[model samples]
Target: MATTDTQPKRLPILTFCAGHMAVDWPHGAFWVLQPPIALAMGLSPSQMGLMVALTAVGATLSLLPAGMLSDHTRRRGPVFAGTFVWVVVGYGLASLAPDFWTLTLMLAIAGMGTSAWHPLATGTLTQTMAGQRARVLGIHAMGGTLAEVFAPLLTGVLLLYLDWREGLALAVIPAAVVGIIFFQARDRLTVETASAARLGDLKEMMQQWTSKTGLALVSMISIYNMAVMSVLAMATLYIVNDLGFSVFWGGVAFSAMILAGAVFQPIMGHLSDTMGRRKIFAISLFAAAPLGFAMPFIGSPWVAIGFLIVMIGAFYGVRSVVLASAVDFAGKREGTTLGLAFTLMDGVGALGAFLGGWAGDFDLAYAFALASGFAMISGTIALGSTLAFPKIQAEPAE
Candidate 1:
């Protein structure tokens, strides 16, 4: 279990939202640039898949430790701010990579920086803002979703004047500024922990996660992430490579997928608070399943673009809700639980990205279809595990 302040402090939702945006910006920017980078390097789909998978590997390496550190640390500001700087430095160097393998290594390093923020920040958010978990998590998610919505389009516009490397370099500027702000303001981000992170805590967390209910929850979220991550990695390629769109249009397409999430994340978060995480999650997944399955079959780019909007909109907030639910089960170990949840999500998601990339080699449409199937499977898992999820108490009518 983790510690908490006796007198709750005012939630720094906006500050953390900014942090979330800064953390996610590089990730979204790099993802959209993959098609152009691959073309420039004369890389195949499999190699791209490997790069995405390795990036996930980098994230997994840091996520758990960061989460545990958050649980034990008295002041989280330095870690939080430092992770932001880490992202800036990693991605900035990635921009200067001279070769494919070097580029992959740099990107993986950046991935580590990007992923480390989640446990420190999200764990704090969930623990401190426990009562309104869904709503706050939703708002928090909007920050990242906003970055996801904008990064691709911004990178695309930049690509008009600069090469992919320059675009990558340019994207880190805002994050660098944000990182400096976080570091300077580190004192305010303190969370007093009752106990230090220990071997027993780690053993308990591992055992709990490996338990029947824990494994079920983990499997459901992991499968859902597989669908979401694979699509995120493949959609831009589908637009640029298969749809005959320019890199700018690929940016447009990728940004469009996340646009609704920025608007709907908080709303869905509120609904999840009042309605229930499991129900809303299942609805979102079920709704997205068909849309994703049908995307590859759509011949017109315009229609496919529309489908992307609706499908992704339905998928919006699902991750936030999932995170909130996992925290609900954490008792006092919110940070450790988040670390485990995120690790499972990205680790399994790595496999999906790898396999999806291979499928893209044959046909991007096939990857999209496969992602749809994963969504369906995940939704079914959610629906079946009513007993596994914590029961929600709907908020009173306002």
Candidate 2:
């Protein structure tokens, strides 16, 4: 029988982080690729809305099953490594898609790989570093953030010389390599699965998530995620179509947004680990609201990009903190809890993306305003929940 490696090794974590980096590469490119692909297919704004909605459909469908599997399975390395290859295949097929619906279907399949990643990867990390979950999860987030920051910039550069299809095809090669490496290193990275979860435990977990405080936390995660998806989808379109910027600038703008978050993530996570998750999470959402509201009005390319930086920096910075908070509330079934949170997040986000896209068809400003409203409302809910549950203030990760 294989024994668990109780001590965390640097190399294993690095391999894990690389796997995260590889799986997320395609997602990072989504914003930059959407405009050219829409133009190539002659898709209307409504069709673009449909595309965003559909992109999340597969993710929402897969997350819960993946989470349950992760919780029960002893060896997660195979599944974890497989998610990387899954993304490669999805993107490869997407590159060859001949029509709008075909491309949407393939991209949606790719989204599943990313959605499944969070529950398995993050759940294991939370268990491993149960005491310092926010900090470790923050580091894991940086790996994905690095890919998100570079993938679009790289795709933008590729666009100058190659078609979007070729750019997507080229991305598959690196992800495939990472998958193989992860497979080879599976022994080192395998999660020591918790004792087999029972049906009663699962049912109890569901009840906890639906309780009053649990409902408040879920509301914050879902509403905030919806606003994030809407803003990102609309912001990408607004930059390329309304502002008349090249795809390169669109990539730069997207990278700026992610890079800012990357810089703030570790800081936010450390603060939350010491300061408590609720305050940090609520503060970040509140800070982001005004910047998102201000984005549509800015006409200058550089200023608009600057706003993207600060806005996303605030929200995405605390993302892991929010996840860590949910795990704290879960008290058990960390993987399943994360799965439910992500399912709600992506499900609501899909609807918001569709609505934002449709609103963009009439006026891009409407999309921005709508997104701002979401952030504002989310911040209000988070603040209210924190005040109502004062005992939860400064709750420890353990």
Candidate 1 residues 1-398, lDDT tens each? 13333324554679888888888898889878998899899988778888888888777889989999989997887888889888889999999998889998898888888888888888787777778877777888888888888999999999898899998988887788888888888777877687987999999877877877777778888998888777777888888888899989889888888987677778777887777777788888887788778876798988887887777777765788788778765666778888888898898888888888998899887777888898888888877777554552232221
CA shift of 298, model 2, Å: 2.6
Measured with C-alpha atoms, the lDDT of residue 86 in candidate 1 is: 87
The residue-by-residue lDDT of candidate 2 on 319-387, one tens digit each, is: 888877888787667778778878887887777788888888887756766777887788788778767
Q: How far is 291's C-alpha from truth in model 1 (Å)?
A: 1.5
- The local distance difference test score of each candidate is 0.81, 0.79
Candidate 2: stretches off by over 4 Å: 1-11, 392-394
Q: How well does candidate 1 match the true structure in TM-score terms?
A: 0.94
Which residue runs does candidate 1 get wrong by more than 4 Å?
Answer: 1-8, 387-398
